[model samples]
Target: MGNEANARQLDHHPMHGVLKMSEFINALQVGEHHQQQTIQAYTEYRFAYRICASQLRPVALLQITYVLEAISSATRPTIILQNRPDVASLFTIDPQTGVVRTVESNLEPGSTHELLVIASDQGLPQPLESTAFLSVTVEKSNELRPQFDIVWLTDNGTPQIYENLTIGYVLARISVRDAKYDSELSMSGCESICMKQTDSSNVYLLIVCGVFDRELKNSYNLLFLLSSDDKVILEHPVHLEILDVNDNPPRFEHSLIRVTFNRSADQFDVPRIVATDADHEGNARIRYSILDTNVFSIEPDTGILRLQKEFDCSAGEVRFRVVAEDGGKPPLMSIVDVIADVIESNAWPPVFTKPLYEVSVKEDAEPGTCLLKYLVSAGLHWINLYPFDPYLDN
Candidate 1:
C-alpha cells in the first residue's frame, strides 16, 4: 500500500490477515531490516543459554549436534518466531566479530565458551545478530576401575636339607572383577615364588600383583605374603630340608694293638684292648672275640683281652688276633693282631770249659821243646792251655 510498485510476490507465509508482500519487499531492499532490528533489541537485553556435557574430557565439537528449529506464527509477518543455535555449529563462530564463521579447529576439554550467531544470506547486508550466547562445558564419560587376583602353592609340610619339594603342587586361583572392562592385571616377581627352594628354616613367600587402568594405563602394585611353620623354623628367602641315607660305614680308628707283659705279672692285671666305631650308637654295636685259644681270652661284651698263661719277656713274643664285627644285614668284620712281648726279668750267666790232652812225638824231641800253645777267649774271660803226649811218658 505504501509502495505498491515495489511490492514482491507474497511467496512467503502471511501474518494477521495482512498481505506481507510490501513488508517482505521492503525488508529485502533494506537487508532484512525487520529481523536485524529485532536482533539488535535482543542483544541489548543479552539472552543467555547454557550447554553442558556428561564428562569433562576432550571431545570433538562437531560430534555433538544440538539442533535448533524455527516455529511458524502469525501477526508478525513471516518473521523469526524462535531461533536456536546448534552445538555442531559452535566451532564455526568467530570470537572477534561475535558472528557465525568457518573454523576448522579443535576444542579442548573443560574449555568454557560462548557462541554468537549472525545472518547468512547472499542479498542481505546487515550487522551481525547475536541471537543468543551459549555457554558450553566439556566433560569425560566415566572413571577408571581397577581389578586382579592371587595364586599360590607349596609341596611338603616339613622339609629338610637336600630334600626336593614340589611347589605349585597347589595352584593359585586368581580372578579380576573389572579387569576385562576398565583395567588390566599382571603378575611379576612370582616366578621365584613358584620354583623357589627353602634354603633356610625360616622361609617366606612374597608375591606381587599389579593393576593398571585401561584408560590411563596407570599401574598399581600389590603383594601377597605367606609364611611356613612346620618345615621352616625361621623366615628365609628360600626353602631348606634334610634327607636320610646310608652313605657312611662303620670303621675303627686303629686296626691292631701290641702290648708288653711280665712273666710274673698277675692275671688280675690283664690288659684290655679298646676299639671305637664312627657310626651312630645303635649302628656301631660291635662284638669282640679271641681268634685263637692258646694265647689269650676275650670277654665278648666287655672286650677285655686276658692272658691264659704267664708271659716271660726273656722267652719270646706272643702274637694273637682279635676280631670285631657289627650287627648289620651283611655283617662287616674287622681283625686286629694283638702282639704280647714277654721277657724274663733275670738272665742266666755264660760258662766256659777247657780240654786237657798230651802229645807223644813232642817228648822225644827236646825237654825244652814246647808244643804249639793255643789261647781261647770266651765271653769276658780268656785262658791258655798246652798239649802233652802220653806215649812219651812210658
Candidate 2:
C-alpha cells in the first residue's frame, strides 16, 4: 500500500493489528451491549479499539506538543524606562491581561529607574505556558527648580590667614536660608573649614540644601573653616554674634628684640617685621621704636632705621634690636632683630712693617755683625688663615 493509504487505514484500526488476540477479545466483550445484537457488537468493538489505540500513544508526546505550541506563540520584550526626576507611575501587562504597577516621586537626577514584572498564574489562561516580557519606555522630565540660598561673613573679613594666626582662630560665620521652606537645617558633616590661606585673599560661600532642613522654620548658622584654597578646613559651631565696631589696634604678640648683626650689614638699614591685631584698617597703623638710646632711631613715618653712630666692624658682632608698638592706648609692643655681620672687606690695603730681633752669638764672633731682620704683614682680619697656611708654612 502507498504510505498515505497505510496511514489512513491505521487511523481506523485499534492498534494497526498489533493487539493480542486474547486481550482484544476481552476488551471487546467488556463494553455494554445494545438491544439489537449487531449494533451492540459493533459499538463494543469500536470502544475496545479506541482503548487500545490510546494506550499505544505516549502521554509525554502530547505534553511536548502543547509546550512547543506555547513557546512558539510566546511574546517576550524587555521593558526599559528612562530615568525621571518626577516619575508618576509605571504599568506592566501580560498577554492574559496580567498587570503590575509601581509609583515613584522626587527621583534624583542622573539616576536610573528599574522595575520587575512577574506573571501570576491567575494572569495566564494556562499556568504552564511560558510567558514573554514587555518593555516600555517612559521619558524623564526636564524641569529644574532652585532649592536654597546661603549668606555668610568671615570673622576677619578676609579668608586668608598665616599659620600662626590659624590656631584657635574663628574663620567665619556662615548663615544659610531655605527660601523654599521654613525649617531648621541639619548639618551633614563637620561644618568648619580650617587651613592656611594660600593667597592674600580667599572667599568661601557656605552650601545649604533643602534636604538638610525640610521645614523652612529655622535659619542655620555654621562656621565654615577654609584652607588657603577655599577648601573646607574644619567646621565649628559658633553662636551668632553681631560684631561691634573697632576698639583696638593691631599688635604683635611679643617684645624684647634679640637680633644678630654681621659686620657686613650696612648702617641704618631697615628690616621688615609684621604684627597683627583683630582690628581693621585705620585702626591698625603701628609705630615702631628703639627705646634704648640715640644708637638707633626709627623713621616716624616709615619703619626704616637710621643709625646715629657708625657700627664698628672691628668690634666682632653688633646688635640692632628694636621694639614695635601700635598706636593704641597702653600701646602693644613687639621686639624684632636686625642681624648684621662684620665681614671684612678686601677693598682696604694691607699694612706691612719690619720686625727686629737680637740673638746672642759665641765669644769668637765673626767680623761682620749678624744683622737679623724679618718682614711682618697683616691681611684683613676676617680672611681665614687656614687657606694661606700652605704658603706660610714654607
Q: Candidate 2 residues 1-394, lDDT tens each? A: 1110000011112121221111110011112221111111110011111222222221000000011112221322222223233432422222221222233323333333333222222112222222222222222333231122223345455322222222344444333321122222233322333323232223223322212211221122333222224332222232222222234444444553333433334555444445654443333557666654545567754566555677666655445656656665555555665544434454345443534345565766554543343343444343222222232234
TM-score for each of the candidates: 0.28, 0.25
lDDT of 1 by residue, 210-291 (tens): 2212223211112222212322111111111123222234444666688766544555755776665544334456777787
Model 2 residue 50 lDDT? 22
Each candidate: what lDDT?
Answer: 0.36, 0.32
lDDT of 1: 0.36
Q: Which number leads on lDDT?
A: 1
